[model samples]
Target: MPIINLNGPKLSTAKKKELVKRFTEVASEVIELPEEAIIVEINEMPPENVGVGGELLSEKEDK
Candidate 1:
Protein backbone atom coordinates (compact mmCIF):
# COMPACT_ATOMS: atom_id res chain seq x y z
CA MET A 1 0.00 0.00 0.00
CA PRO A 2 1.15 3.56 -0.72
CA ILE A 3 0.23 6.39 1.60
CA ILE A 4 0.15 10.07 0.65
CA ASN A 5 -0.30 12.54 3.48
CA LEU A 6 -1.37 16.12 2.80
CA ASN A 7 -1.58 18.81 5.48
CA GLY A 8 -3.09 22.20 4.86
CA PRO A 9 -5.93 24.57 5.66
CA LYS A 10 -9.49 23.33 5.70
CA LEU A 11 -11.17 22.75 2.35
CA SER A 12 -14.65 22.23 1.00
CA THR A 13 -15.90 18.71 0.36
CA ALA A 14 -15.77 19.17 -3.41
CA LYS A 15 -12.22 20.44 -3.29
CA LYS A 16 -11.17 17.57 -1.09
CA LYS A 17 -12.74 15.07 -3.39
CA GLU A 18 -11.07 16.60 -6.42
CA LEU A 19 -7.71 16.54 -4.69
CA VAL A 20 -8.12 12.92 -3.71
CA LYS A 21 -9.01 11.94 -7.23
CA ARG A 22 -6.12 13.76 -8.85
CA PHE A 23 -3.65 12.58 -6.26
CA THR A 24 -4.72 8.99 -6.61
CA GLU A 25 -4.38 9.14 -10.38
CA VAL A 26 -0.88 10.57 -10.19
CA ALA A 27 0.23 8.18 -7.49
CA SER A 28 -1.08 5.19 -9.39
CA GLU A 29 0.76 6.27 -12.53
CA VAL A 30 4.05 7.17 -10.85
CA ILE A 31 4.26 4.31 -8.37
CA GLU A 32 2.75 1.64 -10.59
CA LEU A 33 0.13 0.97 -7.94
CA PRO A 34 -3.59 0.49 -8.33
CA GLU A 35 -5.85 3.33 -7.27
CA GLU A 36 -7.36 1.06 -4.65
CA ALA A 37 -3.95 0.49 -3.12
CA ILE A 38 -3.14 4.19 -2.84
CA ILE A 39 -4.18 6.00 0.31
CA VAL A 40 -4.56 9.78 0.55
CA GLU A 41 -4.94 11.37 3.93
CA ILE A 42 -5.84 15.05 4.11
CA ASN A 43 -5.15 16.68 7.42
CA GLU A 44 -6.93 19.99 7.78
CA MET A 45 -6.00 22.70 10.25
CA PRO A 46 -7.51 26.03 11.15
CA PRO A 47 -5.85 29.27 10.09
CA GLU A 48 -4.71 29.83 13.65
CA ASN A 49 -2.91 26.52 13.64
CA VAL A 50 -1.13 27.11 10.34
CA GLY A 51 1.66 29.59 9.76
CA VAL A 52 3.74 31.09 6.96
CA GLY A 53 6.66 33.49 6.91
CA GLY A 54 6.80 33.61 10.71
CA GLU A 55 3.17 34.59 11.00
CA LEU A 56 0.00 32.68 11.60
CA LEU A 57 -2.22 32.42 8.54
CA SER A 58 -5.06 34.18 10.24
CA GLU A 59 -2.83 37.01 11.39
CA LYS A 60 -1.29 37.47 8.00
CA GLU A 61 -4.66 37.65 6.35
CA ASP A 62 -5.63 40.53 8.62
CA LYS A 63 -2.73 42.63 7.34
Candidate 2:
Protein backbone atom coordinates (compact mmCIF):
# COMPACT_ATOMS: atom_id res chain seq x y z
CA MET A 1 0.00 0.00 0.00
CA PRO A 2 1.14 3.54 -0.72
CA ILE A 3 0.83 6.12 2.07
CA ILE A 4 0.48 9.87 1.74
CA ASN A 5 0.82 11.96 4.89
CA LEU A 6 -0.19 15.60 5.01
CA ASN A 7 0.51 17.90 7.95
CA GLY A 8 -1.01 21.35 8.27
CA PRO A 9 -3.51 23.49 10.14
CA LYS A 10 -6.87 22.16 11.25
CA LEU A 11 -9.61 21.82 8.65
CA SER A 12 -13.32 21.19 8.27
CA THR A 13 -14.71 17.71 7.79
CA ALA A 14 -15.94 18.64 4.34
CA LYS A 15 -12.53 19.92 3.31
CA LYS A 16 -10.82 16.84 4.62
CA LYS A 17 -13.18 14.63 2.70
CA GLU A 18 -12.63 16.63 -0.45
CA LEU A 19 -8.88 16.47 -0.05
CA VAL A 20 -8.89 12.72 0.49
CA LYS A 21 -11.08 12.15 -2.52
CA ARG A 22 -9.04 14.40 -4.79
CA PHE A 23 -5.75 12.99 -3.55
CA THR A 24 -6.92 9.44 -3.97
CA GLU A 25 -8.11 10.09 -7.49
CA VAL A 26 -4.92 11.81 -8.59
CA ALA A 27 -2.64 9.35 -6.84
CA SER A 28 -4.49 6.44 -8.34
CA GLU A 29 -4.07 7.87 -11.83
CA VAL A 30 -0.43 8.83 -11.49
CA ILE A 31 0.76 5.76 -9.60
CA GLU A 32 -1.54 3.28 -11.32
CA LEU A 33 -2.86 2.06 -8.01
CA PRO A 34 -6.44 1.51 -6.91
CA GLU A 35 -7.92 4.18 -4.67
CA GLU A 36 -8.34 1.58 -1.98
CA ALA A 37 -4.64 0.76 -2.14
CA ILE A 38 -3.61 4.29 -1.24
CA ILE A 39 -3.78 5.74 2.24
CA VAL A 40 -4.06 9.45 2.94
CA GLU A 41 -3.43 10.80 6.40
CA ILE A 42 -4.07 14.33 7.54
CA ASN A 43 -2.35 15.76 10.60
CA GLU A 44 -4.00 18.87 11.88
CA MET A 45 -1.71 21.22 13.81
CA PRO A 46 -2.73 24.01 16.15
CA PRO A 47 -1.29 27.41 15.44
CA GLU A 48 0.53 27.31 18.76
CA ASN A 49 2.11 24.02 17.77
CA VAL A 50 3.53 25.52 14.61
CA GLY A 51 6.28 28.09 14.34
CA VAL A 52 7.71 30.55 11.86
CA GLY A 53 11.01 32.43 12.12
CA GLY A 54 11.34 31.64 15.81
CA GLU A 55 7.79 32.81 16.49
CA LEU A 56 4.72 30.71 17.04
CA LEU A 57 2.27 30.77 14.16
CA SER A 58 -0.38 32.07 16.49
CA GLU A 59 1.76 35.09 17.29
CA LYS A 60 2.66 35.94 13.74
CA GLU A 61 0.72 38.49 11.76
CA ASP A 62 -0.58 37.78 8.30
CA LYS A 63 1.33 40.03 5.95
Candidate 3:
Protein backbone atom coordinates (compact mmCIF):
# COMPACT_ATOMS: atom_id res chain seq x y z
CA MET A 1 0.00 0.00 0.00
CA PRO A 2 1.12 3.50 -0.79
CA ILE A 3 0.75 6.13 1.88
CA ILE A 4 1.00 9.84 1.25
CA ASN A 5 1.30 12.19 4.20
CA LEU A 6 0.69 15.88 3.66
CA ASN A 7 1.43 18.55 6.24
CA GLY A 8 0.68 22.23 5.94
CA PRO A 9 -1.55 25.00 7.17
CA LYS A 10 -5.18 24.18 7.78
CA LEU A 11 -6.94 23.98 4.46
CA SER A 12 -10.40 25.18 3.63
CA THR A 13 -13.19 22.72 3.07
CA ALA A 14 -13.07 23.34 -0.65
CA LYS A 15 -9.32 22.85 -0.76
CA LYS A 16 -9.60 19.62 1.21
CA LYS A 17 -12.15 18.33 -1.26
CA GLU A 18 -9.99 19.32 -4.18
CA LEU A 19 -6.94 17.69 -2.67
CA VAL A 20 -8.75 14.39 -2.23
CA LYS A 21 -9.80 14.41 -5.85
CA ARG A 22 -6.47 15.47 -7.24
CA PHE A 23 -4.45 13.13 -5.05
CA THR A 24 -6.44 10.12 -6.17
CA GLU A 25 -6.13 11.08 -9.83
CA VAL A 26 -2.41 11.83 -9.71
CA ALA A 27 -1.52 8.81 -7.58
CA SER A 28 -3.31 6.50 -9.98
CA GLU A 29 -1.17 7.66 -12.87
CA VAL A 30 2.15 7.44 -11.04
CA ILE A 31 1.78 4.30 -8.96
CA GLU A 32 1.23 1.01 -10.78
CA LEU A 33 -0.26 -0.50 -7.66
CA PRO A 34 -3.96 -1.04 -7.19
CA GLU A 35 -6.07 2.08 -6.76
CA GLU A 36 -7.41 0.71 -3.49
CA ALA A 37 -3.88 0.35 -2.21
CA ILE A 38 -3.25 4.06 -2.08
CA ILE A 39 -3.67 5.98 1.16
CA VAL A 40 -3.50 9.73 1.53
CA GLU A 41 -3.42 11.55 4.84
CA ILE A 42 -3.48 15.30 5.19
CA ASN A 43 -2.40 16.86 8.46
CA GLU A 44 -3.10 20.51 9.12
CA MET A 45 -1.63 22.64 11.87
CA PRO A 46 -1.89 26.20 13.02
CA PRO A 47 0.82 28.74 12.29
CA GLU A 48 1.98 28.30 15.87
CA ASN A 49 3.01 24.75 15.09
CA VAL A 50 5.29 25.71 12.22
CA GLY A 51 8.73 27.16 12.48
CA VAL A 52 11.24 28.96 10.30
CA GLY A 53 14.91 29.30 11.21
CA GLY A 54 15.13 29.28 15.01
CA GLU A 55 11.72 30.65 15.79
CA LEU A 56 8.20 29.34 15.63
CA LEU A 57 6.14 30.78 12.81
CA SER A 58 3.98 32.60 15.31
CA GLU A 59 7.04 34.03 17.07
CA LYS A 60 9.11 35.06 14.07
CA GLU A 61 10.53 38.53 14.10
CA ASP A 62 8.99 41.10 11.84
CA LYS A 63 10.61 41.35 8.45
Candidate 4:
Protein backbone atom coordinates (compact mmCIF):
# COMPACT_ATOMS: atom_id res chain seq x y z
CA MET A 1 0.00 0.00 0.00
CA PRO A 2 1.12 3.53 -0.71
CA ILE A 3 0.20 6.55 1.34
CA ILE A 4 0.32 10.12 -0.01
CA ASN A 5 0.13 12.99 2.43
CA LEU A 6 -0.38 16.60 1.31
CA ASN A 7 -0.19 19.69 3.52
CA GLY A 8 -1.51 23.04 2.35
CA PRO A 9 -4.07 25.78 2.87
CA LYS A 10 -7.76 25.02 3.06
CA LEU A 11 -9.54 24.27 -0.21
CA SER A 12 -13.01 23.55 -1.50
CA THR A 13 -14.38 20.02 -1.36
CA ALA A 14 -14.34 19.81 -5.16
CA LYS A 15 -10.70 20.88 -5.29
CA LYS A 16 -9.80 18.33 -2.67
CA LYS A 17 -11.52 15.61 -4.61
CA GLU A 18 -9.71 16.63 -7.78
CA LEU A 19 -6.39 16.56 -5.99
CA VAL A 20 -7.02 13.11 -4.59
CA LYS A 21 -7.99 11.78 -7.99
CA ARG A 22 -5.04 13.30 -9.84
CA PHE A 23 -2.56 12.38 -7.15
CA THR A 24 -3.75 8.82 -7.08
CA GLU A 25 -3.38 8.52 -10.84
CA VAL A 26 0.16 9.86 -10.88
CA ALA A 27 1.27 7.97 -7.80
CA SER A 28 -0.18 4.75 -9.06
CA GLU A 29 1.67 5.12 -12.31
CA VAL A 30 4.96 6.08 -10.74
CA ILE A 31 4.94 3.49 -7.98
CA GLU A 32 3.41 0.70 -10.02
CA LEU A 33 0.61 0.32 -7.52
CA PRO A 34 -3.10 -0.06 -8.11
CA GLU A 35 -5.30 2.96 -7.38
CA GLU A 36 -7.19 0.92 -4.81
CA ALA A 37 -3.98 0.35 -2.89
CA ILE A 38 -3.15 4.07 -2.69
CA ILE A 39 -4.23 6.42 0.04
CA VAL A 40 -4.35 10.22 -0.19
CA GLU A 41 -4.56 12.38 2.90
CA ILE A 42 -4.93 16.14 2.77
CA ASN A 43 -3.92 18.21 5.77
CA GLU A 44 -5.15 21.79 5.77
CA MET A 45 -3.70 24.64 7.82
CA PRO A 46 -5.00 28.10 8.60
CA PRO A 47 -3.04 31.10 7.38
CA GLU A 48 -2.11 32.01 10.96
CA ASN A 49 -0.43 28.67 11.44
CA VAL A 50 1.49 28.78 8.18
CA GLY A 51 4.44 31.03 7.35
CA VAL A 52 6.56 32.07 4.42
CA GLY A 53 9.83 34.03 4.19
CA GLY A 54 9.88 34.70 7.95
CA GLU A 55 6.36 36.15 7.93
CA LEU A 56 3.11 34.51 8.85
CA LEU A 57 0.79 33.95 5.91
CA SER A 58 -1.96 35.96 7.55
CA GLU A 59 0.37 38.88 8.26
CA LYS A 60 1.74 38.87 4.77
CA GLU A 61 -1.73 38.89 3.33
CA ASP A 62 -2.48 42.05 5.31
CA LYS A 63 0.17 43.96 3.37
Question: Comparing candidate 1 with candidate 3, which one achieves the higher lDDT?
Answer: 1
My TM-score estimates for the predictions, one after another, are 0.91, 0.89, 0.77, 0.94
Best by lDDT: 4
State the lDDT of candidate 1 residue by residue for 1-54, as single tens digits.
Answer: 799999988899999999999999999999998999999999998899988888
Count of backbone collisions in candidate 4: 0
TM-score of 2: 0.89
Whole-model lDDT per candidate: 0.94, 0.92, 0.80, 0.95
* Cα displacement (Å) at residue 23, model 4: 0.0
Clashes of each: 0, 0, 0, 0
Worst lDDT run of 10 residues, candidate 2, spans: 54-63
Better of 3 and 4 by lDDT: 4
| Candidate 2: segments with Cα more than 4 A from true spot | 61-63
Off by over 4 Å in 1: none
Over the stretch 1-63, how does candidate 3's per-residue lDDT look in tens digits? 678788988899999888877887788778866668777889997778888787787776344
Count backbone clashes in candidate 3: 0
Model 4 compared with the native: what TM-score? 0.94
Question: Which of candidates 2 and 3 is the stronger one according to TM-score?
Answer: 2
TM-score head-to-head 3 vs 4, winner: 4
